[model samples]
Target: MKVKHITIIGLGLIGGSLGLALKKQCGEALKVTGVDHDQETLELAVQRGAVDYSTNDWKRGVEQADIIFLCTPVLQIIPIVEQILPYVKVGGILTDVGSTKGFLAEKLLYMMPSGVHYVSGHPMTGIERSGIMAADRGLFKDKWYILIPEASTSPEAVEIISQTLTWTGARITTMDLYDHDQCAAIISHIPHVVAAALVNLLGKYPALEESFKLVGGGFRDTTRIASSNADMWADICLTNSQPITQSLLQLKELLDEMIQAVEKADRPAIHHFFKRAKVRRDILIEETDSHVV
Candidate 1:
């Protein structure tokens, strides 16, 4: 549990930023290794000082690791863990930055090697940008990092991973796997889906070219997340389908209510809807801003 050697698989934004933060905060106390399938990414990670070493060999990367971070896309996490299981050091802690956790927790709990511990984690941070080039050392600062540990996960392992993640300046919190997924579906998953849908709606307009000419801060801000990595979002949607589907249905109901009110020219209903949203959004922003460090 004394984490000295850390191996991060998938040197994308989250993984690379984690490496940079760890190296910055922990200095030489931790030996960080960056792993990616792409040799160019590994070189970039090394050049950026994100890790002490970089490699494409999974076995070599994880063999000496005291803690392994799986920062890959949701779909790839399990497969990568399966491949690295044999090489992972005994008593090492395995964690992840995957957005959805229900499926991951279930599978990882069953697949974890006898000696190794699997602790599921999801950092509620990151920009719309992807890749190591977009990695920022301060990305996780003041952001929420949710940990969902399985019953089989040892308390010592949870404490070790939590302590290590603190070096990145993230606010650590724990949640039940099911609760985490459900909450994520509402706050993270649904927002991404809606953002993409808004962009796609604009794309389908007949006067798209003319409409784009009038594009302002509102549209850009609302749809910024639509520019995020498509493959990763797709994987999230697939893995957290149940919660996401239910949330989407609720969203649809709200939208239908708005559509009916507008169709019927019900001015009072429209005004009330916008008023309620404004009040709720204002309170949400106020409360959130109050918590920022």
Candidate 2:
């Protein structure tokens, strides 16, 4: 599976990282062309050898590539895919790195051009850091990439994308787009929301300063996601609110249970919760070597 010319839109952390990875891992057979709204990012991408060329013009980038990775946020992919449909060549593979997939998958199918290939992809890996400076060439190494293929999607297209992604040290996993969104909502989206809320709550309680001083590794890890880009997180909540809401409700139930147990002095129940949580965390660590579970 060879990609001669690839276009990466946005060229932020995800896009820029992809370009860097592809160029390093598959550079001999690929020419990455980055399209970013920012001039500095474009220049950095070129300097870092992430792309052979960089442009802000969508038409120029789309017309010359065999594959396109829409690295834009979840909410933005729909309109960009719509506008790009007309410009993209007949056989080009169009995929995205959006977190939510249900709405994106449906919208792409609805507006996709006759000859264009659309595959919904979610790279289940990222950092709290932002921009090209924070972009690492090894970001996707040993990570999980979910490929959501539609009924109309070409097998050859799927194979090509899967193989190309694998070249970047990522393993490909396939699942229903809706199922993907549901899982992401629970494990990813809900956690981000809770983290941000935790940080906000800390801000509101000045009296908690003494207690908060003991905030250590666990607290840092739990609240790390709160530092992610607000605009991007907001978009994920908007596009995938259904699953996110469900996740939130489930989480609230669990939290309420814990609160009630503590209030009623149910020591046994509280101990049971911690015991189960520890087991779950241990199992999660065992699966850490996987790209995306």
Candidate 3:
């Protein structure tokens, strides 16, 4: 399917950045429209050249769109899609940048209108900051963007979406719904939880102010993601509960091992634990850095 007109719902960081990148790369070939509830955000998106036009009306925004991107929070995506499905042009494609995919794929696969297609996507890139003001056209550059297409989805639709996303400078790959959610739980969801937990733990201290005074790069770097949007993180945790819980339990086990070693003053065990972590983390960083463009 040849994409010409595109509609992006939710003019926040991901949506705004995507609009900017698409506009910059596709130029006059693609007519990008941005939709947000906030009129100020719509105006800002237009001013930033993120889209050709902007609107607060979902129906009007999607009327002429060939591809509609749902960039809202996980829970809001389905409702927004449901509202706009009737307005979506026949043969149009719909996709998302949500964090979780299993539930989305299960529901959206059957929810799409007969001629319209739904493809689940998650871009594995973002910072703690959000909103249109923080959006950068290069946010997705050199990052992994996973596409989850159901068996019912057409190859033409997937190819069209992939080609469009490629213009953002992302490395595109495909994954099944189950695998995508499971891996995301490990890499993204649980890490956010851990970061929040670390910050909360610090907050619980009796001498919190004093302790904060001694904060260094280690604490800042580790807990940077804790500053991410709480509503979005809450939705992610609720939607992907099982995977997140399982990962958290496994993490608890590791923490228990360390706690026991400390309690018993097991020097060798402590040394072994740190050494093993250092080795694995070093290897992981080395492998990841090798892939950077």
Off by over 4 Å in 3: none
Residues 1-293 of candidate 2: C-alpha lDDT, one tens digit per residue? 35788999988889888988988987667888898888998999899888889988889988978899999877888778767777898789899999988878887867777777888899988999888888888899878888998787788889989988987788788988778999999889999999999989998989888898889999899999999999899999999988999889999999999999999999999999999999999889877745243
- Please, what's the RMSD in Å of model 1? 1.1
- The CA lDDT of each predicted structure is 0.93, 0.87, 0.92
Q: Top lDDT: which candidate number?
A: 1
Q: Candidate order by lDDT, highest to lowest?
A: 1, 3, 2
Kindly report which residue pairs in candidate 2 clash with one another: 143-291, 144-291
In Å, residue 253's CA in model 2 sits off its true spot by 0.8
Query: Model 1 lDDT vs. the true structure?
Result: 0.93
C-alpha positional error of residue 163 in candidate 3 after TM-score superposition, expressed in Å: 0.5
TM-score of each: 0.97, 0.95, 0.97
lDDT of model 1, residue 17 = 97
In model 2, the Cα lDDT at residue 163 comes to 86
Q: Candidate 2: deviation at residue 216, Å?
A: 1.6
lDDT (Cα, tens digit) per residue for candidate 3, span 65-153? 99999998899988888889989989999999999988788888889878998888999999999999988999999999999887888
Select the stronger candidate by lDDT from 1 and 3.
Answer: 1
